[model samples]
Target: MNPALANRPGQHLRIAALLCTLLLSLLGAGARAELQLLDGIAAIVNDDVVMLSELRAETEMIYQQLLRTQNQAPPRDALAGQVLERLILDKLQLAIAQRAGAQISESELDQAVAQVAEGQGLSVEQLFAQAAADGLSRDWVRDKIRNEVIIGRVQQSIVNRRITISDQEIDNFLNTNSSELLNAEELQIGHLMLPLSSGTDEQTIAATREKAEALREQILQGADFRQLAVLHSSGQNALQGGDLGWRAANQLPTAFAIALRDLEPGQVTAPIRTDA
Candidate 1:
């Protein structure tokens, strides 16, 4: 080592020691906080236990997601009543699922996780990385998926065998709700979106447009469009393979209805954008 550099090192060594101590303190505090959060179960539904921290975490996730969807600032107490109702419902369903001994296998959980990733146009690894980045454990996502599958299976078992959507019921409902439901169509179509924004630098816009065009080209090259939609579409129906289920033509935005009218099954179209 250079003699001058070696002589000046004590200050840096002290700073490094201080930083290590601070880091350890922060870690200790974080662990303590986590222990406090899960110290006890806040509620019991039948044989199932609901931890307070788990309920708060889930409620916060749902609330934040709803806020983003609405593109509005969420009220501090926004829909407090509704949120409580949902939590109660969730508890009831979870209890029922536990009683039925409904279980989700790792394979099933993986498939559900894959579907969520595909819906967001992400690979499973990427999705897991994102969850980690969000300060969420991969196990948390898996447990959520497990509960979803169990509850869904239980609900379906209860309803599917006894309840039916008959053609007669559909016809009767359509007649009774003619103004709201008649003259509607469900379009089965796919698209690639490229947004134009003045705030975006020209180079970024061009690159985004290029990616969008490439996606469209791949779609036309016999790449499964539904699979692609499950992976990449940004529209509301992205999770459902871009399926905009049947609704009255007049109920949709005028521009969207026009586009729907112009589309045909198994046909692809150039990108279209408009405000609703």
Candidate 2:
């Protein structure tokens, strides 16, 4: 058995699960705009309404987060599609939790936040500071963490429990990836990005540059980075305030390394350019 799986609470969080089976079916071309409803219906998952706003926010969040961490522009259509699908699956799981009379509690949410902090190798204070840089409030992060946990529990109750992974599969994974996996150290990071795109027209180029400069000013002025990112960033994790949680340096791109070298804790960069 996977050690992590063995170590989990007797009850797992199923509601937070992102089911592989459902991810492809729910999303469409990854447009930056929210998903529109056809005659006032976005999409039906079992019995739920996924508003365009929710879909858009989640997609933008994923996009911004990906760009900041990966340091590469994702194919918008593909990523958006996948994100939308994940949100729908999440909605489905959330609904199931509701049906089962499951409700999240404040203590549970707090525990989730603590779990996230511990995983990141941060003290609660450090986690809050990082979260702030990403423009996320402690409450929001806690709620998000809680949602994921609940979803995971719900998924396990319904689906994961039903599926069985063979020992051979585990053995194969260990054989192929054990050395690097065992040696890896995880780091949780909160990232925010302001993307400056080159313009076709000189005026447009100037305007984009102005926007980037303004974004930097906002950060300097104590404006919330994640909120601004959510509102203005062209990257994916805008909704989550450009948070790219714990990851190894190898998973990040070269440009990110350069950017990180100059950034002090709690400082935001002026502007960075990338080819889309």
Candidate 3:
């Protein structure tokens, strides 16, 4: 199964959940009064709820981090939606881990926390102090790490059960250009296709080509590629900012691989005609 497509159901659920929250937020003041006092439910996953406060905290943390790192951050609502979706997925995975009897002992949790501190070149107490300065409590950091460990364990177990490697396939892989394949570069491609029907007239075709060229020019001149894609793309992942996700060059179509061959990071390619 294609892992990318496998998450469609979850994606749908996330979109529905985000829209529901958005709708509630837009209701009259009287309707929102109770929600403001009691806090709101961002999403309901199985028996667990993702509270609005939790989502807001995560979203704000990420937003602040992005401000410190990237030149620009995604729109606030978009960032919140992404954060809520991730929380929902994490909650589902945690539930699965619980059912599968996956447990992380206190000692293991302490070790994990220590490792995190070591990675940051700080001692445990210093790490806690820094987290406090960053407005994150020690318990929050520990819980986040614990959940991550559980999720990782559950994902590995699921993959092990679902994957089978035939001896012949392994032998073939080892005998081939294995080193090159292992080191192959993966690219995150964003695409926006201006689709055309089989019987499209030359005039219409010309117009579409012109439009595509204009969009490419816009991207070259510092326009946000993903935003433009979301606004105009006719591709399957249009709603996802036309993201094709990370793909190995060898796994992509010959045309795409060739088109991307000489491009550097952040460089846009010239318009290429394709039969879509």
Ten residues in sequence with the least summed lDDT for candidate 3: 63-72
In model 2, what is the error at residue 203, expressed in angstroms? 52
- Tell how far residue 94 is off in model 2, in angstroms: 1.2
Deviation of model 3 at 36, angstroms: 7.5
> What's model 2's TM-score?
0.40
Task: Encode model 3's per-residue lDDT on 1-276: one tens digit a residue.
Answer: 778758676886888899998887777666768556867889999999999888877777666545543445677687776677678888999999999899899999999999978976889999888767768889988998899888989989987998798999799888889778988999999888778989999999999999999999999899988766645766645545677989998778678899999999888888777764
Candidate 2 global CA lDDT score: 0.65
Those runs of model 3 whose alpha carbons end farther than 4 Å from true positions after fitting are 1-38, 115-126, 177-220, 223-262, 268-276
Enumerate residue pairs that collide in model 3. Answer: none
Higher-TM-score candidate among 1 and 2? 1
lDDT for each residue of candidate 2 in 1-276, tens digit (9 for 90 to 100):
788867875535553344433554344433323454333445677767877655655566566555664554455555565566667777888888888887778887777778878976888888888767656677766766777888878867876667687999689776776678666555555555544455477777678788878878988998766655555554444446567777775455556656666566787655666554
TM for candidate 3 is: 0.56
For each candidate in turn, give its C-alpha RMSD to the true structure in angstroms: 16.3, 24.5, 18.3
Candidates arranged by lDDT, highest first: 3, 1, 2
Q: Model 1 reaches what TM-score against the true structure?
A: 0.45
Q: TM-score per candidate, in order?
A: 0.45, 0.40, 0.56
Global Cα lDDT for candidate 3: 0.81
The model with the greatest TM-score is: 3
